[model samples]
Target: MNVNIITIDGPSGSGKGTLAARLAAHYQYHLLDSGAIYRLLGLSLSEHGLLEQLNDDIAKCVAIAEQLPIVFKSTEQGVVVLLNGIDVSAKIRTEEVGEYASKVAAIPELREAVLQRQRDFAQAPGLIADGRDMATIVFPEAQVKIYLTASAESRAARRVKQLQGMGLDVRISDILANIQARDKRDMERTVAPLKPAEDAYFIDSSDIGIDEVFNLMTSHIDAKLANN
Candidate 1:
């Protein structure tokens, strides 16, 4: 099958997830929130008390990734994630889970285990992959590679608003610190570090709106598809 792919990569809170969803809907394509895969694994490890042993026992983490009991179902509302036959769409989005995911993602062996699962999402129509390494590692040959980013302060502000809307009490300072730490971990990782592919189109969304970002992406994608 010849499947065209668009990869949107960036640090957390860069609005890549939202933009990827919009692009998927617009093009009637499959959407892969790749980061969620790591987050789900992290949540599972936390539940099993193995998160702390990631560095000590790499084999176990790879085992879990190879046999993750997870499913992603698309609904009108959005993608609902199921872990072990139970929905964990909300559970995996917590800040704690995000931190756990960063730790596990840094392990090269575990990433290798999960890589194929992510590739399976590419199908006949197309795919919009969103995550830190989508462009840099996962989909280097993607036709449309986008690197969406924003200032640390802007990302933290957006995250604060999102948490508040969910009725969770969060302080901007704390969120900012977490974002900065995650950025460091993601970029400095030994394997598949978070960085834009050399040929990727970069967009700084610090002072822009979603609509504008979407337009920019679509325009580029449309041109690429036409040429392809």
Candidate 2:
């Protein structure tokens, strides 16, 4: 059997990450959380000494992405993201980093630099990749392609709950506005704009349980494999 390449693409707070992780665990496939890579890059350049001009900035961004030193430490608590020996899992979760990540993610040069690196994650065991562009751009030929989605309001509500669980004081309205803004920016970006691939299976998880999503995906995966 050929190694399975599973791509789960979705917007923020669409529960794609958790669903992808569970699928990876179920199949013992290597999981690639591609969004985290861009987040880490954004955090790395947060306090840069000087901003390069637009012409030269792309090269700089590409260089940084090409040499990004990221490590995923699986502790009992969960996955810990480390950059340059610093535990930045929490630091990279803030809104500031997220916005910056969106910016860097839209950079064509930066995307070109890390595109191959993301694809290299597919290997013997199998692979489940999660990101906005995983299905559309990174792994267009993925055997199993899923485009998960939720209402913007639902997504913001989920984010609010997530932040509150993290002991954060956040306003729902603010999150809603941010979500809309991000959606607009992401959909309008020139490079690798967010969209479902033609062959992707669309899923709405706003009212569905994670287990249900997983079961549905796994069954589809089995069918796809059998046909293959």
Candidate 3:
């Protein structure tokens, strides 16, 4: 039988990751944190101090993306990103890495290099992918597509709380500004700009809880799977 796919596309802090994880667990499907893939690349580039060279040499970024020794392990808390056998889950969550990921994520060649890696995650049972362009670009043919979103301020507030829980002093205003900026970049980029697929189901998760979002998503997913 062919593996099925469900994509959840959203801006940062829109609960895409949480919803994707829940759906993955519920359906016994694989989870693909597509944003984390870019963030991991960002972390690698930052570590090697090659972020400055990204614009000058696109090939270098593509090279690093292809050679990344990354692994994703599901845990009681959530997914953990391991870089070359070293757990860098927290390392890649920094604001700086996120900004870098957004920048390099716009490079068409860089995205192409990692696109197949994202596709390969669709194994046996199924996959739940979460990212800005998951529905639009990476998994256009997915059986189910969801576009989740919230106001910039709301998302910023959520991000602030998450960072605070991680012991990071984050200001809501700063995060809001970053969200707005990233939204503009992701929407206006020349390659694979962030947008919902034509047939995607939309959910504004600003006021809803995680379980509410999961229920909404599963309703559509269940319908799709039943038909399949």
For each of the candidates, the C-alpha root-mean-square deviation to the true structure, in angstroms, is 0.8, 1.8, 1.1
Off by over 4 Å in 2: 49-56
lDDT of 3: 0.88
What total of clashing residue pairs does each candidate reach? 0, 0, 0
When 1 and 3 are scored with lDDT, the better candidate is: 1
Clashing pairs in 3: none
Q: Which lDDT tens digits does candidate 3 get at residues 1-228?
A: 588999999788788887788888899999999899999988888788888888787878789999999999999998889999999888787888889899889888889999999989989789899998888888888989999999898899889998999888878888988999999998899999888899999999888888888888888889988997
- Residue 6 local lDDT, model 3: 91
Model 2, residue 166: displacement in angstroms?
1.1
- List lDDT for all candidates, in order: 0.92, 0.84, 0.88
Candidate 1 lowest-lDDT run of ten: 55-64
Q: List model 1 lDDT by residue over 1-228, tens digit each.
A: 889999999999999888988899999999999989999999988887889998787788788889999888888888899999999998888899999999989988889999999989999799999999888778778999999999999999999999999999999999999999999999999999899999999999999999999999999999988999
Candidate 3: residue 31 lDDT (0-100): 92
TM-score of 2: 0.93
RMSD of 3: 1.1
